[model samples]
Target: MINLKMILRIMGILSLIEAVLLLLCAGVSLIYGESIINDFLMVAAGSVIFGGLLLLMGKGASKQLNRRNGYLIVTLSWLLFSAIGMFPFLISGYVPRVVDAFFETMSGFTTTGATVIDNIESLPHGLLFWRSLTQWAGGLGIIFFTIAMLPLFGMGSMHLFSAEATGTSHERLHPRISITAKWIWYVYFGLTLALTLFLLLGGMNLFDSICHSFSTISTGGFSTKKASIAYYSSPYIEYVISIFMILSGINFTLFFYLAKGKPQKALLNEELKWFLKSIIVFTAIFTVTLTYTSPYGVGESFRKALFQVASLHTTTGLVSADYMVWTPFLWALLGVIMFLGASSGCTSGAIKSIRLLILGKMTKNEFKRMVHPNAVLPVKINKIAISPSTQSSVLLFILLYMIIFVASWLAMMAMGVGNVEAFGTVVSSMGSVGPGLGLCGPVHSWNCLPDGGKWLLSFLMLIGRLELFTVLLLFTPQFWKKR
Candidate 1:
């Protein structure tokens, strides 16, 4: 049975966390001397009151949480965060429409980076900080952040961690899950800080540096300027951001292992090998194609190709140039990279490198099986044999992912979106990558999309960010039955 009281208590605690985030934004507003401070303060005050009341209602809640409660809590926490997170935009009158505000906030929290706001630069500093902050918090995950920093969920932390963690497996760096969470977060924060310093060295102002750093490390592509990374027009900035994007795409567990003085573990990781090799191969192909086909020289082509390949491969979505004008083949190539995202257990979304690695090995074994019927070949990663259940789960996940992509594509087309735009938008949204093809391309905001289309894409972002099963399982009939 679902533990309603425990759920409420956790929700209340999460709401308080949201209030703290809002107040931090309000502090920014005050420093900037923006009148929007009132809006943030008001919404934050409301959050505190609401959270306190929920805490009161959950006063005698049980400490234990089952699997169902964990799933429900994780899903509902995201929904609740988005619901409350939208108010700042609404109250500021910056995003006037309810749907627009909700979509923007949802995009931020999901780190999908799709935006309806056309003039991002015109927003006050506070809103921009809040906008970027949401992605940073979300990139590592909100509950996971709580698990790392707070000891509130004493008994059922494992349930919460398992419910939200992506990829086929959840590996712990430390014996204690909370300690593992802390180590991973430490790596995440370290990357963010290092990237910010690099951006500053590239001549970006402090605010833009911090914001872009947050977005980059989160694999979120929200830019302070409408032109995105293109606005700077600096190869230095592009290269730095690209390098950090690739770094952020690495699994935090690998970073944890390195931090714990076990560099060999990360070096020998099969998924890491696949991911880096794929980036090198994709970047080389794109660079060669652009060099011969476009006006770019070899150096320019390499720079652009490396940045774009790294961005989309990590699902970061920060664009340095308009790839829409490039050869049509490049467009399709990027879509594939976006589909095969960077390493698992990091900020990136989409079908992860580990799953792709497993699938590739599985395919190879199939041919071997056909040639030698009696031979037993086990799929392995890091020299450890993968269980049959894991291999099957990976296959099923990819199948369902494609099925949903096709279904959503058709639905978007039926909503009056063009075929190419519909395809790009669906893939981009579902992959948590920003920028799409045709109308939804890099140069454009999603402001042109119909409200219904925005809502549909918003739903796609949520499920995609949560990894299909977490949110979808909530809709399953068996999820709610008492065990």
Candidate 2:
């Protein structure tokens, strides 16, 4: 059964945190000139009032929520958070249209980095801060953040955590979900602080450094400048972001192991090895291509190739240069890399590299089984046997992900968008990768997209952010009916 009261209570808590975040953004506005202070404050107050009322009504709600209720709450909370989060954009009149506002907010919160706002640099300081804050909170996840930080959620959080976390495994670094969340956040925070300091040394202003770190560590690509990382024109800054983006793409759990003084755990980790090797292999291919095909010097070509490969591999959509003008083959190569994102349990979206590795192993296992029937062959990762159910679920997820991507791509193309742009947008939004190619390229924005296309891609962003099953299950007949 769906625990409506529990859902409300949790949603209330989430909304209050969101309200507090908005207020923080409002404070940033106040620190600057006072132009958009009212806009942020009014929305923040609304969030507080709405959240407060929910809290009052939800007093005495049962805390024993089941898995089904958790899924429902997780999906609804993401929708509600995005809905409420978009208000600053709407109230401030910066994003006047509802569809546009929702898309921008959804992208930010999903860490999708797909933006409809073209004049990003012209936005007020408060709104820009709000934009980055959404990504920061979303980096680890909003519900995970609330459950881990706020003691209010308590032990009932596991269901919600399972519903939101990537992959099938719920392996815990600590016995309690809250403690696990704390350690995860500690790693996330440390990385952010370190990245910000490095960016400062790389010559970014305090504000830009902070905001870019938020987006970068989250694998989110929202930039204050229109040209993204190219605005500073600093190779130092580009390389720094590249390094952090790769780090952010690794499983946060690995960081926890390292902190706990378990070096071998990270070293022997299958996912980390795959992620690292793919980065090196992809970057090498790209470097060779750029070196031979592009007019840049050998060193410049290698630098560009390495940075872009890191960006694409991690699904961090920041652009140092316009790669769309690169050889068509390399353009296609990057698009394919977009499909295989970095490690699971990180902020990156798309079919994660871990899943890709699982898929490959499963395929090999199948071929091996063809040679010997009734053999007890199990897929193993790091010497641990993977459950059959996990392998099956991973396969199904990839299938469903492709299906949705294709359907959305068809819809966008039907709306008269260019074929390449439509395909890129579908993959980009579905994977939460920021910039698409051709029309929606890094140099361009999604402002020119038709309203219908915006709505479709926004739904894609939500589904992708929830890891597909959580959102898709809501549409199933079994989910809505009582057992």
Best by lDDT: 1
Tens-digit lDDT track of model 1 for 1-483 = 998877888888989999999999999899899999999999999999998888888888887767788889889989999999999999889999989999999899988898999889899999999999999989989989866644655555878898889567898877888898988888898999999999999899999999999999999999988889999999999999999999998998898688679999999999999999999999999999999999999999999999999999898989999999999999999888879888889999989899999999999999999999999999999989999999999999999999999999999999999998998899999999999889889989999888999999999999999889989998998997887
All models: lDDT? 0.91, 0.88
Query: What's each prediction's clash count?
Result: 0, 0
Instruction: Please identify model 1 stretches exceeding 4 Å from their true place.
Output: none
For model 2, how does the per-residue alpha-carbon lDDT over 1-483 read when each residue is reduced to its tens digit?
A: 877777788888888888989889989999998689998889989999999999888888886868898888888888988999988999889999999999999999899888998888889989888888888888788878866854655436778788888575766888989888888898899999999999999889999999999999998888888899988888899889999999999998988778779999998899889989998988888888888888988888877887888887887788899999899998899899889999988898989988888888888988989998788888888888989889889989999999988888899999999999998999998888999989899899999999999999999998988889999899999998978
What is candidate 2's CA lDDT for residue 420? Answer: 96
- As a TM-score, model 2 comes out at 0.98
Model 2, 245: alpha-carbon shift in Å? 0.2
**How does model 2 fare in lDDT?**
0.88
RMSD of 1: 1.0
